[model samples]
Target: MQRQLIQPYLLVLGIALTLSSCFNEPNYPDTPSADFKGIFKYTIAAGTGVGAAKRDSVVLTIGFKDGDGNLGNDIPVPKADSARYAQNGGWGNYQIRTFRLINKQYVELVQDVNKVLFFPDLTKGKPKGAIEGTIDFRQIFTYGSSFKMYPTKFQIKIRDRSLNESNVVETDTISVPFPN
Candidate 1:
């Protein structure tokens, strides 16, 4: 009876140790990195009469990896630090740039507002280690009635809490629907 109990306990212990050893943390570089995963386009209809308009929305997905696992900001920016955050392009950790193809060339579309987005802390409740995941960012564009389909692309990058910027990733040319 004693031998039987000891054998079962030993087997369980051996199994647990084997499983734990298989879950080794990834050893990625401290600097963040990103890659273009995919792009999806959709149309959003709004209004009825003269105010009617069709807006093109694009969701861009990118894969990111960070070694230190410090990829986001969970705390809200205090009022005193608002100016500092704004000076650095808002309080977003991800920066996106839009480009429209014109005359067989890509020209960056400069907007009065910066296209920055904030992501919540991604390492919550997890051990300090490298993290890899995909993030989807959506953008909407509206054009005049005379406009039609337009070819556009985007470049994106991410920044960690340590202010380390990831490698820039660019999406392939995508056709965007415009008002006709």
Candidate 2:
């Protein structure tokens, strides 16, 4: 009777070990070394008259690569808030700046104070691949009664979990009309 009980236990343990061995853990990639890529595309809707709501928008896309898959932050908890954590907190991983072309020169445009930018969580096995993000801006520029669209450009850059800043990329000039 004792031999029978021990035999069943051994069989169960052997099965458990075999099953565990069959599963392999994922190996994540390291940090990226190449420069980040970005592009800016925009649309303009001219305002008819005063107090008319004009629609002006810009669509921005960015691409990145990281071998270690450490591009973004993990989910945040109560114990780990924004203030407590400084570097690599949660938001602002990707930096984007807008500029208006005037007289053959690019001038930086004032940004909205409440605007928030974030990086997607790309943490995965062999993270050394291309990651892309799309950002849209609408009804932010006002033209009052002007029907002409202003030429604009965008400068974008990215950062990794290790606080490494990638090379900056300036997008091609795009004309954006102001909102009335």
By lDDT, the best candidate is 1
**lDDT tens readout by residue for model 1, 1-180:** 999989999999999999999998889998999999999988887767774677778899999999999887765745444455467756468888878877999999865444446777889778888999999988877656677677989999998877778999999888886456
What's the true lDDT of residue 92 in model 1? 63
Work out the TM-score per prediction: 0.85, 0.55
Candidate 2, residues 21-133, lDDT tens digits: the string is 99764443444433324444444565566655655455555555554556765545234434333435443656678788778888887676423455445654543544443
The lDDT per prediction is 0.81, 0.58
* Model 2 residue 80 lDDT score: 47
lDDT of 1 at 175: 86
**Segments in model 2 whose C-alpha atoms lie over 4 Å from true places:** 1-52, 74-81, 84-91, 113-116, 124-148
Candidate 2: clashing pairs of residues: 29-67, 29-68, 30-67, 30-68, 141-179, 142-179, 143-178, 143-179
> Candidate 2: global Cα-lDDT?
0.58
TM-score of 2: 0.55
As a whole number from 0 to 100, the lDDT of residue 8 in candidate 2 is: 92
